[model samples]
Target: MDNETTTTYRKIIHIDMDAFYASVEQRDNPELRGKPLVVGGPPEGRGGVVATASYEARKFGIRSAMPSKKALQLCPHALFVRPRFAVYKEVSQKIREIFSRYTDLIEPLSLDEAYLDVTDDKLNVGSAIEIAKQIKQAIKDELQLTASAGVSVNKFVAKIASDINKPDGLKFIGPSAIEAFMEQLPVEKFHGVGKVTADKMKKMGLHTGADLKKLTQDELTGRFGKVGKFYYQIVRGVDERAVQPHRETKSMGAEDTFAYDLTTVEEMNDELDKIAQAVYNRLLKYNLKGRTITLKIKYHDFRQITRNQSFPFPVGDLETIGNTAKQLLLASGIDDKRIRLLGISLSNFGEAAVKVKGDEVSEQLKLF
Candidate 1:
């Protein structure tokens, strides 16, 4: 490579808090510590699910987004509590503050995970590993929480490295070592490979990065569609995306997986109404309004469909959410299909989050 065209490797870090919401609840309430605790809606409530669970609860297979009723069946003595978004957001802010002390290139994937570009450390820390160590220490000392950090030359490798060691684990993959690292990774562990895709890849005799490398880019693309191009490069330890700071939330919405299937329009409508209200409330909280509304329905047999409509202007009202979702569901012609899940979301954010009403809501209530 010419001098001007040589690759300039960047030091990137991905940090993920360990069971964040459940940890916060455990920290604030001493009585909940060292026990199987779940943070989310009560199991008896309609559409209840586990938002997150402590490591203790996870021992019994409790997990984030799992149905709380199933979680109860898995661990009968598990304590389930409603989520306190305000508290969790506060902790998230504190975590971001700590990151800012090291680098401004911070992209939050959620309240619990973030990616930081520390190619030039603000603290003048010579090593990215040291910077990660300081960040993990700060969270432990200040917030009484643990975070896993993954460090590497690029975002893709760094993200995978971070999960290698969980619940306060740190791993680093250097540029020279990344290729060997990628070759050993399972197909399911790649960024875009879900369970279904992994199964398909297995059937194709591609179970590892090495197996995938045997296929040419054209062949992979032919088999996996557009994402195959990504796999072709990533299996070679190449990902050129930067760590963007202002990664905006493209869409915001609420969804629910019902405890029982709904076969009637009345039951489905009632459920959609609740979901619309939840979506509307979130829009207000985020100070976001969108021109498009999307409805998602999952049938009892696991078939799913999504329908969307765009208005000429932005909408952030309860009526619009409920009516638009109901219309879409009806238009979908569910007929006698039993629905197991329903969701409503707003998108096409051409505006910023703002105060929708004249009354001043507390800053503590602000969530995005």
Candidate 2:
């Protein structure tokens, strides 16, 4: 590669906190240390979801988004604690402060993870791997928490590398090794490939990056829509997307999976009211208004669907949100159906209908 080509490779590092919520609980409570701990809602009543599980609890196959009831069943002796978002946010801010010391070009994916572009670092730390080590050490020394870091020439590879080792680990993948690393990766291991997509790929005999690379871009796009183009480039280690520091808010929303299926319209409407309040609170927090409202429903059988309504003017009131969602639900013919989950979201923020950075509000609040 020419000098210009070589210089185009940006040095990026992805940092992910180790089992953030559960780790925080364990750190603050001496009795919780070294024991199987879960941070989320209580497993009693309808049974809430697990927000995160301590490394000790993970040995029993506990994970985030699993039902707290199931987690308990996996490890009956496991301890459950409700999530403390206020404390987690405070610690997240401190973690970002540590990142700011090295580079201003930091893109946080969530409270627990972020990507930092340090090709021209403020501290003149020429080696990306060294910067990652310093940042990890600082987080451990200052906060008494551990983090995993992945250092690479681009965001995609770096993000994947960060998870290769977990609970206080670091992995480095240079430009020269990115291709081979990607080729060896399972389709499920690709950052954005979810279970459904992974199963689809497997059915088609495309199980790894190398398998995916066998198809042309046209063939992949024809099979997987526009995202296939992304897969095509990513598998070849050609992610040119920058580490965007200021990503716009494309949409904001909240969702809840009930403890039991709601069979009555009144119950569903009441649930919508609570969910709308959550979405409205978030809109007010961000000072945003949207012209579109979307309602997502998942039935007791795990089948899902969505309905949306759009208006010419933006709205942010609780009444509009709640009522509109109810209207959408009613129109969707919820009769004789057991509803397990409901969600409300607002979007089309005038000129700010752009890509979002960090986690979407719906994703952040999905377990609520």
Candidate 3:
């Protein structure tokens, strides 16, 4: 309510490239820009999955991580292209260079997504949203690709707002609108809530942002343990975390919440299909493979659970991935309770991306 309470919040910007790899393909090849282009593996390439697809490809339901074979089924005519990680990394560097010109407090989640803390920058940018626009313009002009930006008082809302509109879009969540903004958000879409937590919340009759705001911190933390604290703050738009540059990215993964909870093993298997697709899509983008696969579940009473399995060989195939995750989920006998959300994460990383190493490694490579 007071100015001190308000000023304590920092200005954060989340920047995400629009169909990153696909946009790069469109940028280099004049013919691919407007046409439906799939920048991934060969359609007939065995074990291949889509990394990124242009907006045109999306019309055919040729989405990222859909097997190249399945994507062909959806859009046989869609153009299929292999990932050019070298070129993309170059573009990523160029964009990051542009960001450094504004502020050094930039935390890159991946090559495509980053969080910038510009609350007390030397650049003297007037408004957070304005700074986002300028950065987007710079990326467009210099890199020849589009990016979507979100600006807010802190990281949680800014990340969500960035995705509200995609591919050359900008969204702002001013401090005045934070409460209303959070109240309307779906519980499943909360940044750290993930699929498991969302399912639990739903079974507890919590669905929307308004529902979450009503729950006490003790109740949430009692149910979710440490993550409960995150839920408690985000529902009230009270993220206090700073934008940490040089943040260590130990791994990359993805998860999704279901519209309906699962009661039967059959139903859970169906959910794994979707989770596998999501994880595979992220794997392709990060060009990463992992030895460990984790299955996350949320029960009927807001109870969160996780089960994981490790492999001697790296996992890059979809069927093996889905089956592995399903086995872990059922192995835990977690099916007795009704489930609301299912998620999969491939972690325990062994190395940097095969195509793109960390900035430090790249610097070393340059020296050699």
Give the number of the best model, judged by TM-score.
2
lDDT of 1 at 132: 97
Candidates sorted by TM-score, best first: 2, 1, 3
lDDT (tens digit, per residue) of candidate 2 on 224-298: 999999999999999998998877887888888877889999999998999999899988777788999999999
Q: In candidate 3, how many clashes are counted?
A: 0
Clashing pairs in 3: none
Error of 3 at 345 (Å): 16
TM-scores, each model vs. reference: 0.81, 0.87, 0.67
Identify the leading candidate in terms of lDDT.
2
lDDT of 2 at 172: 96
For model 1, the run of ten residues with the poorest summed lDDT? 359-368
Model 2 residue 308 distance off true place after TM-score fit, in angstroms: 2.9
- Position 329, candidate 1: lDDT: 97
Weakest 10 consecutive residues of candidate 2 by summed lDDT: 355-364
Q: Residue 280 of model 1: what lDDT?
A: 79
The TM-score measured for candidate 3 stands at 0.67
Query: Which pairs of residues have clashing backbones in candidate 1?
Result: 287-353
